[model samples]
Target: MRLFLAAIFISLAVGFVNACSPADKAALLAFKAALNEPYLKIFDSWKPSSTKCCSDFYGVSCDPTTGRVADIILRGESEDPIFEKAGRSGYMTGSLSPALCKLDRLSTLIVADWKAISGEIPACIPSSLPKLRILDLAGNQISGKIPADIGSLGRLTVLNLADNRISGCIPASIVNLGSLMHLDLNNNQLTGAIPSDIGKLTMMSRALLSKNQLTGSIPVSFSNIYRLADLDLSMNKLSGLIPGQFGSMRVLSTLNLDSNQFYGNIPSSLLSSSGLNVLNTSRNNLEGELPDVFGPETYFSVLDLSYNKFKGPIPKSLSSVRYIGHLDLSYNHLCGTIPIGEPFEHLGASSFANNDCLCGSPLRTC
Candidate 1:
């Protein structure tokens, strides 16, 4: 009787192994077949004999119960020299495989930082992968407009397409990603104004859109993202008043809007905000008196407002920022005695250079 029970248990285990979906097996094979030689080597473990794709397939994970592919990550190891050879670059090469869409259970697809994958992102991905949560194709050579259909991936949380050659206007439909938290499209050729409805991403915490060709005023609606902590929109053609509503971002840590055409006084509310760490608005057309309201509560470490039209005396309150380390007030129209103290005394003449009639310990006597 014991031998009979053992035989039954073995048979059940074999039956479960045989139950692996045939359709998923064919789909993965088709996806691998689409890639070229050196790239195919990355998947040496993917073999015909390995019927259990969940265990044997390279960079592929499967659902334990369903035996369906759930993740596909084919990124190259940058630290490995064998992966960086000239013509034999160890990274996966070729356009994204349409066969990949056949895996109905796929949730995370990240093929990034390889620099070999070219061509557009599969247009059908959004509809094909309804459960996808992370779609990172950054640091590749993929070009062309981001498909508007991508917004259909309502379950998405992290979308990173940075460091690519992608171009064209950012689709307003992207704002539909209600669950998205990190949106990075920096260092691309993206043009046109940022979508007016960007504030719809109320859950987003960090947005990096710098080093693009975007233009027009920053949408006023962006202030709605109260969870935003790091916002970098530098190296674009954005113009208009810096949104005063940003002061409401109680947790904002780094705000960089340098090298744009933004004009108007720096928002006094922003200067008074408590948790700010780095504020760089240099090389713009900003014109106003530097606010003297910063204090011990305001823990700014780097303040760069150089090469602007600011005019006024150096603030005595500047010394009150106990953690101030990097301060640059040069190339502005300011007239007054420089503030002297621990923070101020540590700064050199260059920090206050090119300003109008600035005199004190760092310069001649006032």
Candidate 2:
């Protein structure tokens, strides 16, 4: 009797390891049914006869203990052996099926760069997938508002939806993403004011939202993010004074606020920030004498301040900067001799073109 009982226990353990949850298999099949990827034949291995859906299906992973689907990583632009054999990138046309929410244990879902996946993000995702850590569906044609409850994903760290046609105001609750580190929404059709509490995302390192229709003043609260390194809000309709606190950030290296409706003097602290190296404020209503705040720490790869209402002589402090790779002060109302320095030696006439009464080596001598 003892030997028979031990054999039965061993058999049950073997069965547990071999069996795939029927519900998870069904959910995956429904998800596959909605999309069509003809070239790669990626889903061909998803067969009903296979008992191990976890091991059999392409781009699917399952938790070993519970036999539940855990991840679905399928990138259209990849260096996988399959893409190398096919000699082309992936192209799929279909909506993401809501059945994906049935994978309640899913941790990471990345179906990115397909270029033609058109559909609103499954609204049920936030509430249904509590364990999700990385949700990336960028480089697609997906449209519609970001789910309002997106902040409910408490464990999410990377949220990338860039290069899509997604529209609508960034949800206010987005500031609640306590664990978020990388927030990218570039090249979208989004509009409205950035959340005033965006500074609450202390974990964020890069906040990129360029090429949108955003409007509003730069929030002073943004200075609270000490880890923020790169902040890009260019080509938007944002107006109001440039935040002086931006220069006080701990690790901020790149600042782009060009082509907006901002008006006021360029913040002097910005030109003196030890870490900031890239600055562009061209094509706005900014007016005043350029700030005389350049120092030994001033090192810029690109400093574009053209197409504004700046007047008076170019600041002599600019000549003392450590380096200036590309400088553009054109189309302004400035009148005086351009400063002579190593930083300005390589600049051409176009760098100072169209400025009123500006005369020097690059321009006509005063």
Candidate 3:
């Protein structure tokens, strides 16, 4: 009787495995499709069934009760999806059928540092996958401009579209991403002015819009972003003054405005920006002397004011900047005498190169 009972128990286990519903079968199809996907080669050997646990699938995760594939993590994993056959990495080139939208419990979707995924992002991305918390399409070949209807994803928190060929203006509808904490759109071909209502993204912590063709000055409403920590607007065609409203930001730390066409003086109030530590105004058309408002005690570091039209005597107050390092004032109209200060004393004429009248310690005597 005991031997017969053991045989029956084993048969029931096999039957239970065979009786899994079509949902599990759909998951397996998706999983097999993911295996051949150039973006998922890192999981080539993954066999979730072998281990009888979702954790066995290298980059795939599942919902607790439904046991359906939900989250997909492709970045910072053990192995990069090999592109030896396709000649490019992260090449997830296939139609995103509505089947992908069925992942109702999905949360995060990271595809970083992959380069070959082409074609439009899943059209149903925003409207169907409402539970998505993070959506990173960074470092891919995604070519379409950000979908103007992106606001449909009300639950999205992190949106990264950096390092792509995506063109067109940032859609005004993006302001609808009320839950967003990080939005990176750098290193693309996007043009047009930043939308005026960008301040509506009060939940953002880090906002990157560098290396594009975007024009116009930053909006004043940006000052209201009390949670903002890092703001990068460098290497675009953006012009106009650094708004005084920036100084009002208590949490702002890094502000990069290098390699733009921005003209005029650095706002003295921002020079004394209490929270500011890293400030770059290099390769612009800025004029005027460095401000003393950035007291010696101020925490400005990594200050680069090089390749601008700034003229007049070097401010002695700058010598008090004990924390400053990597100071580059080359190729400016600054003249008169170089300040006699600790680090300034070591800088040579090369550091003040191409200046019309800069003389004394750094350069030759006037």
How many clashes (backbone N, Cα, C below 3 Å) per candidate? 0, 0, 0
Query: Residue 83 in model 1: shift from native, Å?
Result: 7.3
Lowest summed lDDT across 10 adjacent residues in model 3 is found at 76-85
The list of candidate 2 runs beyond 4 A from truth reads 1-19
Q: After superposition, how far is residue 326 of candidate 1 from its true place, in Å?
A: 1.6
Ranking by TM-score: 2, 1, 3
Q: Model 3, 1-366: lDDT tens per residue? A: 999999998876654443333454355456446323544465554544443334555566766555555677865323343445435535454423345566666687776665656566666777777889998878877787787889878999999989878899999899889999999999999999998888898999999999999999888777878999999999999998878888779999888989898999878877777688888889999998867665666676667788998878777777776566556788888777777776677666667788778778767776
lDDT of 2 by residue, 219-305 (tens): 888899999998999999999999999988869988899999999898988888878888898999999998888887788998899
Runs in model 3 with CA error above 4 Å? 1-40, 43-53, 76-98, 346-349
Candidate 1 runs further than 4 Å off: 1-20, 36-40, 78-90, 363-366
Could you tell me every candidate's TM-score relative to the true structure?
0.89, 0.93, 0.83
lDDT of 2 at 128: 99
lDDT score of model 1?
A: 0.84
| Between candidates 1 and 2, the TM-score winner | 2
TM-score of 3: 0.83
- Sorted by lDDT, highest first, which candidate order results? 2, 1, 3
